[model samples]
Target: MRLVLRVGGLLIAICLVVACADATGVPGASGADVIFSDGFVPGQMGNWVIEGDNAGQTAVINEQLVFELADNNIMQFSTLPDVTFDNFILEVDAQLLEGDLGSSYGVLFRMQDSTRFYRFEITGDGLFMVERRDGESGWTRFVDRWTETPAIQQGLGSTNQLRVEALGTNISLYVNDELVHQFNDATYSSGTIALDAGTFVQPQAKVAFDNVVVRRP
Candidate 1:
């Protein structure tokens, strides 16, 4: 009887290990394919470059671009040149380092140049907006905007996920698992992607980002 009980326990342990292995193998949860990743390790600064004249923005010890806590965390692409995409899904995580009165940060897609692109932004106040730019219009008008009930201000320096799916002319934006915006624009099928930061009141703001994934569709 003792031997039989020992064997049963051993079998249970094997089964548990197998279950864990299976769970870890699952996609989109355990780990991603990781086409590109940056831990901001020093001496590994080729894939990205800092652009613009923004002060207080630098790669932190964690290998991430950290906006000065008082600057509204506004950092832009310093190295990646603009490119076009046909169909793809882009995902990024951004956090506000300091919650200012009107602090905001976001990702830009279908960006044709410094002046034009589709803007998807979120604020410390749990508000979000999607807008488009046509020529010199300056984010012409918002395609969608809303204030999330219960106000999802994670906290100062808390990261939040932002995802955009583009298939042909159709586009969709998701924030923290919620589908916030969707639209169709045939004017431009593809362009570059960018990060954006804007000033609000006086305290300034900082934003940090990580886990930026882009998958071709």
Candidate 2:
């Protein structure tokens, strides 16, 4: 069930659910038309394009899309199919299988290419960040630094339901069925989406993802 929390005239939507792995395959939503999904049960990447410093580090392990990278400051991203939407909800299940809680992983959407895209990320240490990439020049943090929030479940081996919704120019971020932060910015309107995982200070960060579903919001 989704609840729209109106704050300062901006609509922030978060789907409230007790157990994230419950009934529907469509995140926490009920009766939503699933646009695209990948469970990794086939044990293959298929047409997904790999990008970043840890480009081909992602693989299908134990029926989940897992990215196990080496060293810090390395990010691995796997671009999916034609998942461009002006107003839609994108949700995926991710787990910190191995690494320090400071490591971060999430989704990248509204991408112009491999280098230009908007990223929404959540750390295992109860922190979140928003970033925009500018090709070889690198990324610029919209929030400047990592912002801590209790909405994210901390510690290793923890699972989180990461959600990013783009409704017009409004974007909301949610984790574990709770709204973390929201902002409005009209940048790229049409582009692809990708799964991203990276490390901060940890020597390595390993995360698993599955059941990615996109729907109309």
Candidate 3:
């Protein structure tokens, strides 16, 4: 069953049951032809957005891209404004510095804009989800629910390697070098990418992302 709730001014959905697989491998597109990369060196975010306000803040500090959400039910994301990709292998290291265990952070791909994209998210408590957004229309869950997997490191201060490989309608998601889900969708074909973090109930979510690389698949 799926439950949708209105919390802190945003609509949130929860999936009650889902089935997924787990398998391990290297985290990145190590030897593939590189298309883009960012180590997030301090004060050097050429293609990424940096912003701060009452809702949240995003910045590059200490060699990492960080997101700090100030309120519950709010989501924050920073995108590579000029980079667009299709049929590529993208990977990054995301660590939850501090937040509620239910908070999620991950990659958004085929992002036509802020409100239109595909997201692969994992919570600090070891649950993962895949979903899509289509502007004011609504959100769609690719899986039945937020499924649990042993692949995530589970807890604050733990870094998880998040990877996504997209080829045509086939998209695969991985966490900490383990395959978590693979599915097919034709909603979007090509667009930009982003890193995002969102809060569920409690606020103050701080997540840092690093070593982002995208390669031709």
Question: When superposed on Cα atoms, how far off is each prediction in RMSD?
Answer: 18.9, 10.3, 8.1
lDDT against the true structure, each candidate: 0.55, 0.68, 0.77
Give candidate 2's whole-model lDDT. Answer: 0.68
Global CA lDDT computed for model 1: 0.55
| lDDT, residue 83, candidate 1 | 46
**Can you write out model 2's per-residue Cα lDDT over 81-195, one digit (the tens) per residue?**
4446667788889988888887778988888866678889888888888877666555666685789888887888878899988888888888888888788877777677878
Quote the positional error of residue 123 for candidate 1 in Å.
0.6
What TM-score do all the candidates reach, one by one? 0.71, 0.78, 0.84
- Taking the tens digit of each residue's C-alpha lDDT, what string does model 3 give over 169-202? 9999999789999999999999888787889889
Off by over 4 Å in 2: 1-32, 43-56, 136-140
Report the lDDT of model 3 for residue 210.
83
| lDDT of candidate 1 over 104-214, digit per residue (tens) | 677777867554567777777677767776654434444533455233455676667888888988988888767877788786677777666555434456677665566
Q: Candidate 2 at residue 105, lDDT?
A: 83
**After best superposition, candidate 1 residue 147: deviation in angstroms?**
3.6
The list of candidate 1 runs beyond 4 A from truth reads: 1-39, 43-45, 51-56, 69-79, 99-101, 144-146, 149-153
